[model samples]
Target: MKKYIAIVGSNSKKSTNRQLLEYMQHRYVNDVEIEIVEVAGLPIFKKTRDMAIPEQSKAMATKIDGADGVIIATPEYDHSIPAILSSALAWLSYGIHPLLDKPVLITGASFGSLGASRAQAQLRQILDSPEIKARVMPSSEFLLSHSLQAFNTDGLLIDAEQTKWLDSLVKDFAEFIDISAQLNHTHQEDDTRMADFSWDEGTTDKEVSK
Candidate 1:
């Protein structure tokens, strides 16, 4: 079965970052299924007590685990990613790190001139940690500054050039995932062969050295 890909946005309601995610989804012509995991309903993460995690949080974790790659769309607030997004990250970290070793692409949009660049940097740091271990996209694509003017009321991207750029980013990300999977499979096969060879060599060396 083709693995699923997830697009996560910090905001639940109509958000420019969500619109950017939608634009990326439009680029998919392949068989892989893409699902959007909204982080709106999850409660703020707390480390002191065993905070009863909401069902939505658990569902998000399961979806992330099942996904082959994740696209994170977040908006900037006070020069960093929204608190809700951070909380979701915390939740994911505590249990089974769904994001560990996962390929993740992150982008953001805002009304300011910086185009949510600060938030993107902060997110990159978070995702780069050992716990997350995500392969981040290098090029900063899908950063729609003055976002209110870039997208329509129906959440469609209004700028044709921006849409094209985002499409290219998504296509590249998909190809990257495919190549990574192939490399991993090859490594596993090599490991299996090496194990078998090691067993046979050990038996032969013991008899010869005797």
Candidate 2:
């Protein structure tokens, strides 16, 4: 089966972060299927809420669980990711915990000089929890700035230099995903062998006693 990837961002409309994600999707072509997770309809997370989560939140969690890797892009608000992203993260921290040990690549774009540095930094901290073993790319290599003019009307990256850099980033992430999948496969094999060995040992001991 083809590995699935999920891309998420804070905006619901024509957002620069969304544009960057679309650009990345295009680069992958048929190698992998990329699904964009919509966070717009998620209700603000509240622990004391009497109502169940919105359907959108459930859908987002399903997508994250099914994806081989997740990519997050966002705009900086008050030197951090928007509350919308935070709320989504909090909501996904419930049962199943799909984000735990998941491969994640984070990037962002903005009109400010710091690019989405502050927001990315905050997100890195959030993902640093013991439950989440994320492979966050280095800060200098992942942040994209001055996004207002960086993309074309069709959401394609037009700058040759920037495109090259973005391509490199995506390639690196693809390699990381490949390695992670291999490790998971190996771990599963080891687990299966261990289970079989235990069963065999039990059978041999029973035969010896008989």
Candidate 3:
């Protein structure tokens, strides 16, 4: 069975984003294995003098590296991803690139009608940045609007159409993972270049001219 890491991109005790992933976990139990990961206890991102990465961050990166693909469920705050999720992504990228060329699927939920659309767009930019380089599924998005009423007591999606849409998207993601794996040659070259690049190193204009 193909395994995926589903990141709950929220720190709230009662986050609807978590609920969305949990629902996927249960609904797709037969089609795929989904392990839901939390981002609650990670320390806020900061630059250390020694450039040390926290053990917790390393552990999360390990999990991501082991998984076939990733699913990020985000919630919008002030039309952007919550600070906690951004911090978690920062930790994952600093000096380590587990997400480099990894396949990713993005989902978001919001209480209002917009359904975290802005946050998801911002997240795509972050994941596609040079440092992260996550291959997010193209032209695909799953947004749960009015999320407070979208689920039932059992944490299952109440709307049949929504469930059907999710089912199709998940299947597509599985195929996408397989296709991405076939491009390992390119992925390797990108990884090598990323490993050689560093944000801390830069040349002056004089050095560039020389």
Candidate that would win on TM-score: 3
Residue-level lDDT tens digits of model 2 in 19-128? 77777777776666777676786777654323356667777768877787788887898898988888887766633256665678888888877779889888988876
**Runs of candidate 2 exceeding 4 Å displacement:** 1-4, 49-51, 131-133, 137-141, 182-210
lDDT of 3 by residue, 120-207 (tens): 9999999999989998999778999999999999999999998899889999999999999877777878888888876556755454
lDDT of 1 by residue, 1-210 (tens): 245455555665878777676655654636456676788877787643333566777788788778888888878899999989998887776544566657777778898877888889899999876545566767754577898788777767788887787777777877877766654544445434433432123345445333
Output the number of the lDDT-best candidate.
3
Q: Residue 73 in candidate 1 has what lDDT? A: 82
Candidate numbers sorted by lDDT from highest down = 3, 1, 2
Steric clash pairs (candidate 1) = none
Off by over 4 Å in 3: 202-210
Error of 1 at 23 (Å): 3.6
Q: Give the 10-residue window scoring lowest on summed lDDT in candidate 3.
A: 201-210
List where candidate 1 sits over 4 angstroms from the true fold: 1-7, 26-32, 48-53, 182-210
